[model samples]
Target: MVGSGFQRLRKSPWEILSSAIFSSILVVSSQLALAMVPHFFPSFSLVSMLPIAGVVFVATVVIGRWCRRLLGVPASAPAFVLFNVFFLWGVYICIIRQAVPSLLDAILNAECALLLFGLYRIFSSDPGMVSYDSSRSTEASCNGFSDFSQCENSSLFPRVRYCTSCKTNIRGFDHHCPALGNCIGQKNHRLFMVLLTGFVIAESSYTMCSTRYITRFLNTSRVGLEANLSLNMVISTMLFSILQVLWQVVFLMWHLYCICFNIKTEEWINWRKYPEFQLNIPAPAQQGSAFSEIRFFNPYDKGFVGNIKEFLKPKH
Candidate 1:
């Protein structure tokens, strides 16, 4: 079943009993952690956890709603709460209690929550879907369409191609993210970029805060509960921080380059694979020449400042 992820009881009864025993042992070990090693540093209060906890709950609920609509799967809510919100919350809690000061964690996580809400905006909005007639008119020149083809509509919408997967014409269609269960398109591309930027900022803060604790625990001469817990939290948070920071930084840079050129990932890929592919809006049909002559040059190139303005400005 789709949501019945782990219901199978295939383990033998002996295996089950052994697993239970082992779990009990692990629990006892964890409880004894502070006792066995008094030097270990982390001490938490419900107060510290509260702010981040509230953020996590709000993120889970908001993203759950947006993600379900994007993916068209209402049944994913349980997993969304379990993995996206609480799982991350658990990791975050480790950092708040063991690695970073609670006040700092709360501040950083609040910013992270705002970014998540921005991402939810991207996920929930349409990706600038163009009408079929609008796309079809690209063959002719009319109004601002300088391309050879005639354009009957002067309303001037982005020239879009048909998307077989979506069964619609999409303006500036990027590609479908299976994880998001939605296509990245013109409308939300900028917001998506900002979301990635947010993750980078948040993860960087987490890694930095974790580093001091990790250094102290690793350097300690004595081995005890605090060292072990600190080690676990530091290692876990740092690995992801390194990965996310690198990936998001690179991804954001590449996308910015694309934005400067007014292209999407899908368009870039197509242009690379196919020699005849065009990168910009259709060229003016001109007094004589067809729009195809300068294939690499972007028709939408409004210089860096203009592009930035258009990109940052909100659209209806």
Candidate 2:
């Protein structure tokens, strides 16, 4: 499935050609900017980076636009502007300049590209929404019903709650991610965490591989720093990597916690908001098992390994 999806995404010859052209341009422009410090600039200044930034921006836009059109990922996959700046810095300092060993750089770039493709897959896949008429039935349609199987979206085994923002009874709706322009739900939450995990791995290795030079250049004397454009490049890239790693670690860990406990982000947030939500079980005598006033209780929570399996299971 993954291979076929990637093939479909890259089926366009024009897209492949355009991406190759922009990637080549990115490599050349970044290398030229990095080379400026060694030969052209004895004391490079911030003002000198304007030309480099302009060139990188053009290349980024071209590639970013192509990715958006092909993969349905946002033009800026990450909404954070800092990520983009750091990406450019990373390219200029390490990737284009070949800061790491040739073989190591190739390996890292390949891994990073695969992680990026994974993100595109998660973003583009439909996340268990029942929008079509054929997929929904009157009997299966849940109107905030207690028995989740009654919902058309059986992918959401338990959750079928009204989403005030979306104005629909969403099944297992975790939350809407504006960055991806999609809802992270029962079907895609696992994929979302996997994507986050991939970024964590990619960023960690990238940082580890380049940390030595980045730190050395950052610690250089002011005059030496000015003479070495890589110093600025490395510093910015390091900062960006650090920020991303920290954020991804915390974010992924939190989601892991949620998965372990068999809870959704949306439920965790509003669990306390409604202490005594009514459950319609169609029988007042069977209230204890079917519907109870068990505050903050997550019915989906199995055991530790059990919940983990639930999370790892293939999304419907």
Candidate 3:
């Protein structure tokens, strides 16, 4: 069942072609920009790279739109390409240009590789998909609540949700990540967290390194800095890195909080719907009220240490 579901996730020919085209443009454009830097700037200022970057950006946008509208490629796939583009630019223009220590460069590259691997694993691995078992009655699957059988999605087991996007029931369902092009659930949740944490660290470091580069090498004079394209390019990278770091950090923190309490994001958002939550919370509950005196009771929460243990424990 998992295999069949995974097979469904496979990309169409058009999608593969679209990805190849997108990647090719990014690689060729960046390399062309780098090549032009030596001849145009002589001293190799980042200013020379901007024109190509703009062109590449426009080209990718057009291709993305065309692919989505015509070939029907998933919009989320472009995010992976965008990430690589940023990482490549950061490494080449900032770290290399600034001549950061080899140790730092190696570390950054290693993190990038690991992040790519983690993403691949998340994309390819099953996220604890729950297969339908006709032999098991709704009473058994729904914890003796046969009434739940009347529900449209009665086949789902406890804590399992039907993902419309993936067309499968995800066990310990968290949320569907369009960017990852997969559902995050029991199996891949750990990998998702690791990837998020790594990206937050890597992007933050990239921002720092780029800032250091601008400060160290660029002219400090007000006039010199004013309208400086090279400075602008580096600054743009810094801003991009900062933006990524900000969102990822916030997202990571939220996930960490949920993990500490042994709750899934889906459950956190839709707690009232679950009988466990309704039973735990006192009577006369205001529906969908954000503020309540009664603390949410999570049956799965086994204290901080225990929750962490549960999260980290290997899954079969």
Candidate 4:
């Protein structure tokens, strides 16, 4: 049943629309968020904003459009970067001003970073034009002959096929990334993972650092530093927390689906098979167990949830 639903989603127009809308929101919101950074952090010189904002904007536009063109999908790397930077900036402000961030700030920052990282993974590692080569080596034996089967001795390197879009025989070809506007074959996969890891680390560090400040605020009885618990503050924090959790769940499921089925984002997006071969191809291999795959810096890992248990487990 789950497989059937996934197959349906693969072909759905709604997914494309959702991807586009989400990407646009990410682009616009990221720009707005970047703009707000200056207002929030008055101490920072305007020059600092230009470099970060410029890199973020260019990366966002390129990635977003690339995803759309390659997979008929859209994503907002800019928004993810914006939220992360600003959220950290907010924490930095709280720390600088009061020497401690409130519990509210810490909670908000941590949650925001987690949410942003999840979104970034979903968009960034979207497997724009990548797919498995069913005809190459896993032929005959692994073709969809049985349910819940595995491929045996599949060829890692196969003959190249010309990509209509790129007009080149891509080596170690996984798929083309519209976001990066390049093929994410073997050579570039590591780079993509590195980009994601950096973003996650930066966002998480900012959140945790701010959280320390928040704890300090909680411990103090300083005259004006106590949280006022105003209606607006309470409501915003609550809503943000709820949204963060919800997004986290969505991300978790998506990651699990990808890992279990071994489907690349690109393959999932542009899944197609020659008419003669469609019925014979078996489903792709599922990777490692969910628990094992989620660890930090796993070569094949795509999102933070793969290591959720490790992340959530209390440190000794």
Against the unseen true structure, what C-alpha lDDT does each candidate score? Answer: 0.53, 0.56, 0.64, 0.42
> How would you encode candidate 1's per-residue C-alpha lDDT over 119-197 as one tens digit per residue?
5676566776654333333445344443211245423545353344445545667776544445677787777777768
User: TM-score for all predictions?
Assistant: 0.57, 0.58, 0.70, 0.34
Q: Over all chains combined, what TM-score does candidate 2 have?
A: 0.58
Model 2 agreement with the true structure over 149-268: per-residue lDDT tens digits? 344454544465445433444456777765554667767777787777877777776666656555554475445645355555554354445556876799888888988988878778
Question: For model 3, what is the alpha-carbon lDDT of residue 1?
Answer: 17
Among all candidates shown, the one with the greatest lDDT: 3
Q: How high is the lDDT of residue 9 in model 4?
A: 15
Worst 10 residues of 1 by lDDT: 1-10
User: Candidate 1: which stretches are off by over 4 Å?
Assistant: 1-86, 131-157, 163-165, 219-222, 225-230, 272-295
Give model 2's clash tally.
Answer: 0
Clashes of 3: 0
- Encode model 4's per-residue lDDT on 66-173: one tens digit a residue: 656786554433444444345445535543225434774565456556545554554444222324444434455546422111223323323223344454433334
Clashes of each: 9, 0, 0, 12
Best prediction by TM-score: 3
What's the CA error at residue 34 for candidate 3, in Å? 18
| lDDT of predicted model 3 | 0.64
